[model samples]
Target: MEFMDHLHSHSGLLRLVPRRPFPVTIAPMQWYRLEFHMANELGTLLPSTFNLSDIHVECSLLDKSPAALSSHWHIDWQLLLQQGAWDSEPSLQIQFLIRPINTSLPPHLPAHLMVMVSPTYDGDNSFYMLPLITAPFCLTSKRQTANNLVPNNRAWSNYVTQHMYRGFSLPCFDQRYFLIRESWVHGTPGKLWDSALVISDALARQLLPLNLTRPLKVLDLSAGTGVIGLLLAFIGQHQNNTMLDITLTDVPEALSLIHDNRCLNKITYPRLSVAPLRWGIDKDIQAIQAKGPFDVIIASDVLYEPIKFQDLVKTLDKLTTPSTQTWIGYKRRGLKLEEEQSFFTLCHPRFQILDRSLDENVIHCFGWLGPHAPTLTTSLPPCLPHRVTGVQIFHLSKNSPQS
Candidate 1:
């Protein structure tokens, strides 16, 4: 039984890491491919016993086309069973398991085990036996390959529909910080933002406080997924135990999505509202100001184009009050590092940079400016940890004249 289990485990790992021929062609383009290797040994043996067996696996690109193409590859497993047969001929079983890492169930099969035998098997070779097995398993795929395996979108879609997206529900967060909404296009799945995570961390770190006695008004500019505002509302509920007024502002195309997300999340207060505001446009700024005197403003992943920096600054200048705290989170992208520095350089005099932190690919922060703050150098705090790639946090705050 132990040997059989070992064989099954070995085959399962091998199934996950199949090699491909180099320089596989996709249409006219050729791509390099790679494979992920699995570790040895099934469950640990009791003492010093050692078990060894030769395992061989092969994979080939099958089809890649609109209907079906030959660029995508399917993995085929062939293992030589050498162990002495007790009562039955050796067989191979493949298991398809779906497990999510973030405490959320993955969208497919919990566990599917299929037993197969060589065509030469004398008994029951005509039918395949599939048994459902429910257990936790790691989910990963090949990291790299020598052959460019054009993904089979059709098959992949079928696999996801049949296996991945059906059984799982949207993950729930304690603070109600995420805003998950479907795309405006029909049949598209919904999206979520982790605003609550950001805001809670910032507040705990003394970057900002929840001032409930005074009405907390939040402005989510370029609100891609309305994550920032959603987080603010979640935090406000905890600190003030009251509803937060949040304005979701974005371009015309995103407004409908924002509204849909707001409704889907069922955010009940400080009165969730949506407004169309294009960055750098006066009409848009005026329209956003109609809500007026925002206490906190948030933006996430909004700095991509360099041309939009000045307009963003202009919009910020119009929407923020002298004492307001504005938080902007952005993922670093092409030219983003230099462009962000340039943005801070221009806005440092008018706003005080309060705090900043980098996690994964995102930059999180809080900033404030006095009614008439002086020009300040863009120097981040020394305590911020340096990232593995040597990227340091860039934080600038309005300095008091004496300092």
Candidate 2:
């Protein structure tokens, strides 16, 4: 497939001009430039009519208590206009003056900047928000600068390769960088799938309240590069109150990448570990069982395959204690809604699944503007002006046996 075709296939409406060096990194107190050019799936300019005055830049870290990171920095809109950053058409360009990482702002590590274009300035005009136009950059202290390495087989090498995700950062609770290896199946760490973000968002909002008085043992089952588990462990370490022992498990093929990612984060928590686990295999389950029951279980975007759904639930049943809570975040794969429905139907008998899709409380923590406006919900801000159609998070606990 051609380069542009590949990108259009993966990301329908979002296109990055000069899409290279993804997971854009920045040193503390340095200056960085951001470009905002948006187009729909057909490669046509979207929202073509907009004055510079109609553009607004909003910045925030994806955090439990997110605060604006763009307030005190300098922006040069005129320089951007002169250069014509967007194909000599109209594009928004803003130079960001990086600042010291503010601990007060709930530690949204990989900070994101949103370029919103309000179509009309007339009284009470409705506007469209483009979530694709984002600056997914991270700020590192001088000493930790070496952590950001450019991969040789770069995922976002060109417009074509960009469709195949190489690495991505989870912004909140410190930036967790993940390197992606191609998977034969759907779930991989490289793509910031909605399910992963949902799990991260849930943890950030309720980390303290959920584990306030007791230390909790956590598991990220079928973890792809350990994104969900690693985020929990790092966030717990940052909090210093809720003690968390995290175990990241997946098939043997995924173990090496998981180990590499754990190292990439420089985890010093002393309790995080990774091992191989295949669902429905006795030996694999035994390895997990050796660690005993976990307090909480997290799985993201792992239920798409219909054949493995039973084994997955069985594994969860074995690993979780009576009081343990399992959180599953799922995004619909293609048009197959029945597959999701079937997974839930089988799960209903053993688990009391609470539908927490698009929880307002979680949204509020991550800077949710009124529903229709372009709001930052987790890492990928919903730019569509509508809720993400099929993405949701469910809270699962053991259901009592019926007499």
Candidate 3:
């Protein structure tokens, strides 16, 4: 099948566009443009009907504490959000110049601009649309920046709650939880993926049909961004499901992202579990098995590497028992159908494919209203949104019952 060639899912997700060849220096009282754009996720760039008036734009210090921010200098810029200016079509991006206003040069130095939806605005409460600050930059002053302090990862706060999820027919947890992600520049594990969104929403919807009277155990394999297991954990809490035994696994390199995301969501032990897992590692599989037999196992976009097909299948065969319901969400970007079938071909008698479906329109409404409104726009690599397919879901279970 024809698939879209996109760098990453930025659609519906707001981003502070990185300036090409990042500026070497930022001077105070000089106008530097900060362009905030929502990257495209699905094949389509969703429009933003978000009221312009509700959004706020300003500059912020890179390493200053939230408490310290209130006492220090303040910088204000054009908010760009106007009544008829942008609300007519509702753009996905806004840019304004930010310059220090106060008399202080800031011994710590002001380094980034913040684009946030005002706390007072009662607009769509989706986490994907939460505010974003630009990546840290250099200040003109000779003084050290960030006071030589920079956190490993930048945190974006999205205070959406479980109540917001009740209404969507096909909703994935938006900024509903205070979830955070590392940029691809940092590592791919932390960035959100469209497949994760589509699959999690699909699985969550399927769980609702069970009425969830009993305990539920879940596994999110290759749980980048921790979106899948995290969402289920929230759902489990809402359902009052016992134990809240949700575990997320990925490579060691990827574990920190999952850990950070899980923490930012305020989910803790007994409620959420994160472990380092490599698909073919026997030790990892056995360690994870001790926590099993899961009621449902879920994964997204793990089939991208054709060479690793056997390893992933092997891991699935060992982790799942006859009753374990497995869901795998795959995006066929630039992959041949045969390449995908090859993965299922490896499962053989060890597992059975129960059902398969596609989320053709998982979120067609969530378009990116950026430089190319009604079209794809991102600071990431190029792709065509029209050719993107809804993620493909694979439901599986052990072929025979186990003792």
Candidate 4:
């Protein structure tokens, strides 16, 4: 079977890496490399195991349209997939137009440049896949040296209804999940995750029934970028059978992202709400608990650190009643077997754990079939362990009231 035919996570993604520092001077000639590399679902580069053809590149100024830099720079497409080896350093030679092309950019101010690569696949209804963009680099003058890369914030992850949400195959409604970029620190709660997508898929297919007696109440804990809650809201709004009332909560810093995404999607009060929730904090737990004993509570990729496990369990205990259905989607990074087991151990006292990770209903990868997908895709970062990643689904509920 095709890997994508049964996948639940993204196969692989493309990334543009700069060879070195970018404060280049307007000398006789300047060389800067905007190299292309394929990354696994974990964002680590993979050796050229997949062939990527018919791909497009956009090298342009960050603040201006790609066309604005056309006269100023000429770039060629030298993608990593073109080179069939892992050791090959495939660099594209970007020609510099010593002179400024656009009058809008003042010569006194160095222009910023970013490279974006998008792939066009071969299929029945093939469309341009998600584009991977590089962090902006400063185009400086001969005398300039210092650098301040622009803060990478907010990007839209477009999802066609049929492509992402099998249940959400609404012809008119598509989803644009707002992400805080994948360049976040490990366990940072602001970026989109494969586990979250897995959870989303599970909710759409297995958990949420195709009929609603009451607005199915949902609580998303540690809701980074609010993907789960937002997705539930979108689904409920579109599919009458699955109408939902969702509350997305996270730490203070991460809450703004949820709010922005909420505003970005034009999702407002009643259908969805945003709140600042810090796990283990008594006041925070009390404030959120008042809202639920929710019908369903979703938490994905939150079992990250051992130090935070107790707190997360505490929060879950506070919000769930005997009837609440809690779903957790977890992907282990470098944690030991016992370390991961510790989480379930902590929950043993308050909840009943049903590990359906091995079940056929679970979607191991995202519902996008990217280049080469499972067969040729690999996790190639030497610093990191060389193993493919997978998400585990844990269905938890309060133990029998008698106990």
RMSD of each: 19.7, 9.5, 11.0, 11.1
Q: Which ten residues in a row have the lowest lDDT in candidate 4?
A: 159-168
Count of backbone collisions in candidate 2: 1
Residue 184, model 3, lDDT: 62
lDDT of 2 by residue, 179-289 (tens): 222222333543345455445645655664335665678888888757677666656655565467789998887777666555644556667888888887888998898
Mark the regions of model 4 whose C-alpha exceeds 4 Å error after superposition: 1-37, 47-187, 206-210, 240-242, 368-388
TM-score of 2: 0.58
- Candidate 1 per-residue C-alpha lDDT over 1-403 given as tens digits, one digit per residue, 9 for 90 to 100: 7654433321211111121121211111222223222211112221112222332222222111111112222223334343323433222322221122333433332222211111111122121111111111112233332233456654433222111000100112221223233232321112222232233234433423454554567787777655556555544544554646788877776666556544544555566677789888898899889897887776654555777888987788778766566776543433546776887776776677744554523333321101111122355321211221122233323344454
Per-candidate TM-scores read 0.45, 0.58, 0.58, 0.60
What is the C-alpha local distance difference test score of candidate 2?
0.53
lDDT of each: 0.40, 0.53, 0.53, 0.55
lDDT of 4 by residue, 1-403 (tens): 3433223133333333333333322221244443344444444543334444444443333222221223464334443334424456543333333335455663544554443343443431222233444434445654543222233562222110001110112112332222223324324675566677567655655534456777678999888867778766755654554457788898887877667656544554456778888989999999888877699898988887899999999999989999999989888566668999999999998999998776655654332222222222455211101122366778999987789
lDDT of candidate 2 at residue 192, scale 0 to 100: 44
* CA error at residue 24 for candidate 1, angstroms: 35
**Winning model by lDDT:** 4
lDDT, candidate 3, 223-243, per-residue tens: 987877876775665455655
